[model samples]
Target: MNDSRSRWLALAVLALAQFMVVLDVTIVNVALPAIQTDLGFSAEGLQWVVNSYTLTFGGLLLLGGRMSDILGRRRLFLIGLGLFAAASLAGGFATSEGSLIAIRAIQGIGGALLSPAALALLTVIFPAGRDRNIALGVWGALAGIGGTLGVVAGGVLVDGLGWEWIFFVNVPFAVVAILAAPAFITESRRVQGEHSNFDVAGAILGTAGLFALVGAVIRTEAAGWGSTQVLALFGSAVVLIGAFLFVEARAKDPLVPLRLFRVRGLSVSAIALALNGGAFLGMFFLTALYLQQVHGDSALEAGTHFLPMGGAAILSAVIGAQLVTRFGTRAAYLGGSAVGAVGLLLLSQAGADATFAGGLLPGLIVFGLGLPLVGVANQIAAVAEVPHEDAGAASGVITTAFQVGGALGLALISTTATTRTGDLLAAGAVQTDALAGGFERGMLIAAGLAVANLVIGAVRAPRIRPDAAMVAEASAA
Candidate 1:
């Protein structure tokens, strides 16, 4: 058990934990109908099963990251794993919709703690260079693959073993990760004298603001954007967020250091990551609907259909790391975004008459191919120049962007599709045809968002050679 071997083993454990976290995000999606039917969930209430997780996960991410820094990455990681595992078990046994949603929210809190801690641990363990780059590539690929695989696995599990299996499935992975983690992950925390107290007000304000914001976004489709409830949530979010910023600017030990945004790479990459998430995640949600609703595929069939997309994402992630190594982050971001947008455009043309090969496969493959390029590049850029002590916070910001973006993206795209479907149905179109029309329109919006990512990356992301001092440091290690 030499140092190098130990680090690699730790990476494996961390990645496994991450895969579970990512998997849960979309795994429950395919099981939605089943869960709803079994529990007698209202159409509106059904969305909460997913939204509860996203809101809590997104809201607590910064605090989790900060806790990892102040408390100890390994300690927070274990605690998170334990909590998540317990919640999953409870969810499996839940007989009521309220109980399930509560359990899911608890799971999100665990995820918020685990995800950033795992990423920060990786950044701590792997020195910057080819090793770190490769590790991040694998992590990014898993992020993409996990979401897609969730859809596939969800369908299989729900159809074969029932929807409860979705939660039950996480138990084994959590147990393994909890047992293996202590052996491989060494404890690391910020210097003791750096900060005397945590920024409690900032944490409360930020978390509450984010939760409100995401809740508002989630309700927009059902309540209408201008509804009183939605408007109140939005106003509260703005005020709370503004107050959080004010607190951060004045706090002695800020939850999120305001100065971190001074790093060009971190700021730009965060924005790009958000936009990329909006498009990529939105694509997944809409495509799944198109396959199941429009194409009339069963859960298993729909899951199987996503296999190519998952495979492509994994393959492209490997290549994406190399692209970043050779051409730099800017080039990789630009190239990936351009290609991904094109893929979405192709998907936007899908209709009722379109076949799998003729309609969906091409875009699925292309979108999958392009995802990792952006994903890996954005990841590298986000943490490339971060100070070691703030790695956890940085990781939190990145993860938060992805979670919040996914929620917002799904809400907007789903709304677009729903509205379009209503119009088509009003015009006397068949159900399948109306759904296809809605999906196509939604895909087009997703494509535009991807293009926006390309523009942002080109304008703001700095070009840094992979062989710079960071890689040199890893090579020396």
Candidate 2:
């Protein structure tokens, strides 16, 4: 094997940054209750703590990626690291709900700037042919593994060190990454005369619009879909997003070039990302809640039990990456998503008295297997078909879709499940049993989304590894 000592070290540093960003997703899951109680957040308000970060990260991703191209990835990466670390510290020491949410939003801005630059940096460092493929595989694996670690680590920390440690954990990693990133990696190319105007108006509209849309999805429990507040928010979301789209079409230098979607792989990958994010919402958030709330498991137990799912996901993700070279991206996505759907379906049937071993473990494992396969496939697909000039935008689309879809999914399906469960209980069903029904319904929604993702994968994604094969043939020649 060719020695890649320096490259491997670089990979380690980038992967640490990647893992830190992804880990932030579920690292706070076990601490939701603690945050809610300590901060005195309303039910709807609690979702904001999570959704605010996601919305900001998702909305600004295209801008962030493009900025890195212009400002330089290495500088942007370090700056993002510093900002994220500061935001994490601010969040950790939050004395009030408003402060925490504010810091979380800033953390998201930092995340948005960091993730794409890291990936792009990796893309530049890892040469084409086997090396690039191998690097991407490692990248994908770390993303999945990091998410799993978040759940387990979050549980342990929340129980032992208190909820603040969730944010505290990132400080050291950020400091290390900020210091090390510029040392090993060389700067990548930028477009010679690319348009430089950022869509500020579009940005404001998109962010506020997304917030409104997600708010409606969350407030369904209190106001119902018909309530004036819910209706108005949804309406505002539509109008604002629509305005942003209209503005983008006319802007000289659009924040996100609309042309990226023309690539088939980019479009489908973005959709797949959305489904992937939705699945996480169901798997990590709802699943955690079911084990804790209805099943009455301790937060620690709830977090610990998710290990199987993460384990399966990591293994399957690696398998999925290998399969991509052999079978193609399409097959990996279709097969992996279907397997995950089955897992979600199985989990949807949990009862209040169900044991983890007999009831949830099998499903968790199956779902876990599906996660990595589908996730990595989607990431590979996003950047594969597009030209190098548009790689960042294409990448942005994949991640943006993931966040937007996740927020929508979590807000909508979770609200539906919660509303139905409350209604059933109000109608005289047993409280425990009704909660079970809600959890099942929510899981079913996510499962259906997964199946739909498979459909999109089969329809739009290219199966043959034309690029990989061509690289091989060229080397042989």
Candidate 3:
């Protein structure tokens, strides 16, 4: 019993670390304008600030998690944390756009190593069953809340302090996580098979492939789909990705064991997670811009308005966790998409004349309510069958899919919103009102994607007991 208490304590610390990493993703988003103005960035290159971190982190998650299993979760945790802090300090001082983007990319590498290690460590610390469910519930809640927390805090800090404070804030989180690493969480078994070695070529190919894919998508807005540069980039992505799959199948100790994909729930949950990442996160990027650029709300005001959305996010996640524990993983997953669709439908009606009280607030709240369920339930579903040996890789696959979706989502939606707005304004529409109309159209498209998510979940939900298995694993860990 005493041992169990200690495990929970360890969970608390690990969850805090997870929160810091996830929160950084959205926190910087709210500060983008400030960072741009202070740093003097053009619109075309500005996205690299976000994309650099996301691309690296998402691209290398599988490798990081696999390393944690081989070396030591605690050791890697500290390394990743320390690297993140140092980079943050460097980034806060960055005067040139190139330097800032380079540092952010390095930050992504740190996050890739840190985030999955933290999660895999939690899997090791928590015992299986009911306790695991609760532990993971807490974990899911923290991650879901982290993005919003970062936004609000970023707003407050950027307003009072400066954009640099956003990066500066990570210093404390990284410091505390590093300090706490040695005290709690005993090292787990390293090396899955007889020999453990990283596939460097595979890693390079996969990382380069994903980066190429995302780069192509981002370039589409500038170069057009038919442009030679866009075509070559996309072609390179396809070939590299195809090579990665062939390499993984033959590698003795692949980063992601293909066998894990045989798990039904993991595959379905990951696909659903991709949709969730693409549509939901994409929605946030678009809405934040609409409120700020079109409406001209101060960053602080925009952050304040998001309080409702954040609140709804927490509520839905907690509720979804309970539902997963009570009903079933598949049910929880399907229900999340259903609820999210409703929220997106509510939000799709937003227009240029939309008021904070009448138009945007309801949709934001509704959208928030459904957001957590989409994330928490799918996560549980994905991890349930993950054998202790390959859990991290499985989690990485889920993470990779989601991050890829998120990156593409944000880039695609941003381009769509920009193009549509341009077209409407060129048609002699009111600059303000027509732009508002473009935002409305964008939200509706997001809603339509969410509806597709619902249908996919309904069709694909498999027979499984994810919560029961998750709790069992947590309690035993």
Local accuracy by lDDT, each model = 0.81, 0.79, 0.76
Per-residue alpha-carbon lDDT of candidate 3 for residues 284-324, written as tens digits (9 for 90 to 100): 76676677767687778777788888888877765765677
Number of colliding residue pairs in model 1: 0
- Which is superior by TM-score, 1 or 2? 2
TM-score of 1: 0.88
**Best model per lDDT:** 1
The residue-by-residue lDDT of candidate 2 on 192-280, one tens digit each, is: 67746656787778888998888888988998879999899989999999998898888887876678788787788888888888777
lDDT pick, better of 1 and 3 = 1
Error of 2 at 232 (Å): 1.4
Error of 2 at 210 (Å): 1.6
Candidate 3: residue 118 Cα off by (Å): 2.1
Worst 10 residues of 1 by lDDT: 468-477
Positional deviation of residue 79's Cα in model 3 after best superposition, in angstroms: 1.1
